[model samples]
Target: MSAETDLIKLYSQRILALAADIPHLGHLDAPDGSARKRAPLCGSTVTVDLIIADGRISDFAQDVKACALGQAAAAVVGANIIGCTRDQVQTARDQLAAMLKQGGPDPHAPFDGLQVLGPARDYKNRHASILLSLEATLDAFDAATATSASSA
Candidate 1:
């Protein structure tokens, strides 16, 4: 098969995997606040709700709809950020973006679960779908933090 075909197949597989794991998809119910994000080009939207306690993420969930890439990306983000602090979430976001932009990184580190998206890097059009969840998650975290700060 051709490289394009291979990439498509990879994306398809990831999407299928996410679909099979339906319970993993959706948003956290954060008592603090919630945030939503979308990729206008692809119509992929993810809304994240999170609960923050003592400056750490106490609970998390998300509601997402879009292509396979977006769904899978959201699942990965939700799974990774559950117990993280705001700083840790920010760091993961930065590191994930950098890894996506600079090709693959050490698979054993911050980019572990996210590395599955490496094949997506070559497909410029799908990049937004892949990153949509991460962006949405960060936005949700920011909103949660802002709300917490104001309430304090």
Candidate 2:
């Protein structure tokens, strides 16, 4: 298939709609943890802020400035992140990376919507953008936990 056709398939209406309606958008004030990640190839970026309590995310928000694929991924994360544990986010990230890089299956529930990004697998350069939200989220989680550990 042609690159144009691939692009068209990668940016389906569902992805566009998800990109337009990303939930938990924006930043948090004095969040427990925060992180920002950028995709150098496309200059796409995602910044995440989160609060962790009882080992699960209690609040979350993100500032996304990325391509449709990235935004769509962020939308899925935002919509289902409120009560997720770090392990859940890590597994989702790992599964997504595998799907894009290792010909693995789609990520599981709470993040199954990530399947919309499957068409992006051929575009290796776009993979980082697609994973930006989840990466930043994991970084934020690490930051929060590190702080908690230091204070304890």
Candidate 3:
């Protein structure tokens, strides 16, 4: 097989693995909060529901629909961010964006299984889809925190 074909195969296999292992794939339900993000160009959407306690994420889930890249990215995000605090998630978001945009400060260690998406950085159009879940989760966290702060 050609190199392109090999890459495609690898990506497909990785996506499948992620889908299988993701804790919540279709509809994430959490008691504390929910947030949704959409990429109109690709019609990719992800809704993240989070339950935070004691300033740490106690539970999290996601509902996602998109292409293979989007779904895989969502799965990776959902799996990795479950126990993280809001600050950690924000750091991850910054690291991921940097990796995609500048190829700097590789967070591959924290990224864990998501290293498979390294190949996706080369595809500009796919970036939005891959980032959908992360963005939505961050937005949700921010909104939730703000609400909590105001209520307190």
Using Cα atoms with residue i matched to residue i, what is each candidate's TM-score against the true structure?
0.83, 0.97, 0.84
lDDT of 3 by residue, 1-152 (tens): 67798568647777877756666665444447678898878888888888788888787878888778777777777767877887777777777777777775555544555666777676777778878877888888887788788889
Superposition TM-score, candidate 1 onto the true structure:
0.83
Flag the better candidate by lDDT, 2 or 3.
2
Off by over 4 Å in 2: none
lDDT tens readout by residue for model 1, 113-143:
7777776666666667777766766787788
The positional error of residue 146 in candidate 1, measured at the CA in angstroms, is: 1.6
Candidate 2: pairs in clash? none
User: What's the CA error at residue 13 for candidate 2, in Å?
Assistant: 0.5
lDDT of each: 0.69, 0.95, 0.75
Clashes of 2: 0
Is 1 or 2 the stronger prediction by TM-score? Answer: 2
Q: Indicate the residue-level lDDT of 76 in model 2.
A: 95
**Candidate 2, 66: how far from true, in Å?**
0.5
Off by over 4 Å in 3: 1-10, 26-30
Q: Residue 119's C-alpha lDDT in candidate 3?
A: 72
